[model samples]
Target: MKEDTPPPSSPPPLPVFKMPRVHKQEYWSFVRLVAPSTEMPPGQTAWKTTDAELAYCLKCKTTFKYRSGSSASIRKHMNHEHPHELGSVGREAAVKRMKNALASKRKSSAVIFSPTKRTKKINPAEEEMATRALIEWIAKCLRPLSIVEDEELRFFITLVQTMHGIYELPSRRTITERMQAHAQQLRSLLKEKNAEEVDFYSLTTDMWTSRTTDSYIALTIHFMTDFFELRSYTLEVASFCGKHTEVRIRRKLRDLMYTWG
Candidate 1:
């Protein structure tokens, strides 16, 4: 048998959603006033009225605006809320005064003058004369000590000549041998004169790295009398080590000191 079924009720009408309208008074109260435009560019779907206006604040100095039936409403609003912020001249004068005060303060604290003296120009002739005098003085001082002789000067001149492509200087090995012999001669002289026994000799020690990759420690002892005089001596060199320690360094120095004796 066929059964009668009630027709299905239509689904409840889909709910319609609507955005609430923003009042002109409320919008203008928060935003600064700008010129009214009849034709707003596309994508500007928020502001509907074209005749909206704004107002500017003089203190905290911000601008505010609102929409009203007449300009009386805007004037009344400004008078009620910000009566003291009416004049633009007072604000401009205050800004100018502040700027001038800052400028004056900076000028007072600035360093306008330098304290250091300027360097004077050097005269080439004077410089040359001084250098010549110094060389002559050095030569004269060494002549009495027998260190500066014609032969030694000629040897140095020849070395300079070699640099000028004239003659070759002595080889490194020859130079080393000559230095050793000179050192031995000086040591013997000190021994003969009993100068090494003097306790007030000045000593200078220096360490340098050679082109041959060897590290050398050179010690020079200058024996002088009570009278002001300089005695040149050969410098002794030795190898240095890490594990040798400070005691070993002192021992090496002692050995060097004993050599003079």
Candidate 2:
């Protein structure tokens, strides 16, 4: 019989490399919403961020945590936990902003503000500013591009504008249209650069499941500059039906490459 050997010694502990700490002020993206200078839903004290992505809510009364990815969740928590904070004016402001947003649209590139019965004086400048801010906010964090039809969210933004003096937001249709145009513009620019600057390219593909248990695959392209700097960008993602078998993956890959190639 073979003698039992002693277990291998444990690997040395990982070096205690201290990561540089991020100050709250360094998170300028959240400055507009969480900073004391901007709007804060009543009953909530100034918010603080540790990782620049997750925020600690003082209004929560305890060490309440929420992601800065969606201001909607933060508002939902406030509405449920502190309903009294969102007063009458806040609600009315929301309704007014929604109404103003739903007013007829024009062919101009800028967001139009329509004056209604309740609020006779509509400031187009403010409306444009608010629209730009809202769209930019949604785009920056990769939030759902379909935030236009989110009425409850529109109301929250309206209430925020009450203190921040931002104008009423645009309608969902407008938001969608503007985002599409902006995306197209960016795509055109990127395609031009890739065709001009890059000589050769490589591709990477990933198959994964979403929260809803949907299977999908994303394709990313990689290239290098004359200086040997690497660059990568996701070209597109599509649903990969059936099992993630190699055959199925190969078929999908063929389809995408044939189309793009």
Candidate 3:
């Protein structure tokens, strides 16, 4: 009997290549896009119809055509024909250009604004208004509370203070505490207003068990205002410790109602 032989391994996949941005001077130095042509010059081979775009090498007489406007064929040609030249000019040149551009940008931005030395004291009311506005903006935009500590944001605020009265930006902890306190105050006021204006309310509930076998319940109340407008508010979402029996659930509902009232 003949011994079995394993099949030959497949070649590794080719690397994906993307066309460099128009402003990338380093890449444009060796590659340039040209109008597509069916005819290759006298000595060249015939072109395929599948070619969507054409690019010619700047350093040599070779031209490449690729499907779907891909730059991979052009890049492969460079890798094979101009490996040493490409290595000396590609990644290193791009990185150096980016660094120089960023340094120039920083220099230009620095000269745009000059912070004034004369600092005026901001009043308590003005400071409170500014803090509330900042909080509101953060909440409305769904921004992380730690955005207060961002250097760019702080710089912009400093620029504003150069003309207006100076005020300190709140810390993350301060914003968190204020949000919690405001939420509690709003809940209290809602309960008080509901008691005064609503005669009866319809309650909706959802119960679920977590992956860890822990159960939780959510209670929501729907009521009509004196003006006949319907409104709904979520009362609580609490964890249930014991068995979720009817009696236990009833007791929990009663306790939640009492707490809200």
Ranking by lDDT: 3, 2, 1
* Residue lDDT tens for model 1, 158-183: 34533436665689999999999867
Per-residue lDDT of model 2, residues 75-191, tens digit only:
555566555334333545665655665442212214444644233345999889988998999999888988787978875655464443656679999999999886666565567
CA shift at 32, candidate 3, in angstroms?
A: 79
What overall lDDT goes with each candidate model?
A: 0.53, 0.58, 0.67
Better of 1 and 3 by lDDT: 3
Off by over 4 Å in 3: 1-176, 210-214
Residue 194 of model 1, lDDT score: 46
Cand. 1 Cα-lDDT: 0.53
Instruction: Superpose all Cα atoms of candidate 2 onto the true structure and report the RMSD in Å to 1 decimal.
Output: 22.1
- Distance (Å) between predicted and true CA of 157, model 1? 2.6
For residue 48, model 2's alpha carbon misses the true position, in angstroms, by 58
Q: Where's the lowest-lDDT run of ten residues in candidate 2?
A: 10-19
Candidate closest to the true structure, highest TM-score: 2
The per-residue C-alpha lDDT of model 1 at residue 77 equals 56
Clashing pairs in 3: none
Q: Report the C-alpha lDDT of model 3 over 1-261, residue by residue, as the tens digit.
A: 996542222211222223445444444467655434535657745343333365555577455655554556656777788875665566578658655665665565556454663334589999999999999999999999999999778756545534446677799999999988867766766776677787888999989999999999989989888788899988788898899899999999889888887
Clashing pairs in 2: none
- The number of the candidate with the highest lDDT is 3
